[model samples]
Target: MYHALLLLVQKLSYEVEEQIFSEVSLAIQKPESYFEMFKDRLDERGIDSPIDELAWISLVDSLLDHGLAFEIDWKESGLYICDVVDELLDRKNMACVSWEDFEDGEFDELPTSLCLNKISGKLKEQAISLASLDIESDCYVLITVPSSDTDEMKALAKEAGYSIQDSF
Candidate 1:
């Protein structure tokens, strides 16, 4: 059930991510109840991971408070969600994938073709894009790097003058 929820959240269309928060917020105002709703979902499935449920609840709250309305282009949002989901699944897999199966010693190695400088630059690009959006100062940036490379990426991110979230 937890896996299914993860998949559903991951499969959430980009527009849904952008719009559902507002819709849900307007549909339901009580933050405590909102949390309970998610907790209920997890409880219904007998999922034991409290942390995971809390993460989703927080994400929903953050989305609503920030006025993150979905972009109108269905195709674009759909594609964006797909990419986000894929990235998420990859990160999820990294937590379980064995080190021996990894070709390189470093599981966190940036794609060889994608230069580290470019990847770091892209984070800045995202930072800029996010600023153009309605995200608040307290809004957090969630980076899902390979589990093996999380520490290094996090350090690099900090060095680049960007704050990184340690947890979702």
Candidate 2:
């Protein structure tokens, strides 16, 4: 069930922060790989027998909702417009949209960048400034979250990990 996945993320986050962060981070960055890794881990959890592509997508969504995870994504997310695609399609123009990113494999493309930005905007309206960190140094878009969360994520990547792992 979705609840089990959410609990697995939160309950094991601190105890297994390294693995947890890696899976959540990869869920968006490399879903195919993420799923391969996730399925293996899910099988280990004993949550479901032979765990074949469970509602892992919802698990990721729940993680963001609880501020337990953040995503690396495009910054020009504002440019994504479903209406334009719709109008183009109305004219019978050849076009294709993929929601495979979220695993539904349907619906319009909703980039994680736009979703994360909207989350930042909502936090700002509430006087909270979610930290935008540049662990990978792409210089285009930064991973957005608070210091602690980002710090954990930083430890998972080659460019972001601290030189001293014992401290992390």
Candidate 3:
């Protein structure tokens, strides 16, 4: 089974952090009401806010403000959202890689240095990506790599002056 991992490195203002937490908590606890409140926004984005997938939806919602969102198709293990900052949008320095990329063997085209696998854990041999690096406003970067590649990711993170804030 191939599982997906999500990682975020950013410093949030206390107000923004609190808002995200509260919104996500509400979405998780009362998905129906939460969906209703954000229905128009979600609809504008063409996302289906199903109550059963509250956890995933809430995560997506929380990150939406940061210009990040993941469209997860659970039944198919599909991840449809992959956004990278403009300058490094090529295959070599992609900010995000979609499920389609994996199915299409795109990872094989990456250099070995960029190819990362989890060093330990149930999620082994999974390909990872640096995803996004926002240095200007937030000094934030997002990584979607497997646990095995954590050391390499950490090294890169350190060089970039970002400490890991959250991982999933």
Instruction: Give lDDT per model, in order.
Output: 0.35, 0.37, 0.39
Please identify model 2 stretches exceeding 4 Å from their true place.
1-67, 79-121, 139-168
Better of 2 and 3 by TM-score: 3
Overlapping backbone residue pairs in candidate 3 total 6
Candidate 1 lDDT by residue in tens digits, 5-104: 2332333323355444443442234545544556555464354444423434444344333333121121222223324323533533422222233334
The residue pairs found clashing in candidate 3 are 95-131, 117-149, 118-147, 118-148, 118-149, 119-148
> Would you estimate the TM-scores of all the predictions?
0.26, 0.23, 0.36
Q: Model 1, residue 168: what's the lDDT? A: 22
Q: How close is candidate 3 to the true structure, as a TM-score?
A: 0.36
Question: Per-residue CA lDDT of candidate 2, range 1-168, in tens?
Answer: 333333445532433455555555566456566556556454533434322333343343334333343433443233232332223223322233432342443322445445444434443443333333232332222222332343444343223221111110
Candidate 3 residues lying further than 4 Å off, grouped into runs, are 1-15, 45-49, 68-83, 86-168
lDDT of 3 by residue, 13-53 (tens): 12255666666566657878888878876675465765444
Best by lDDT: 3
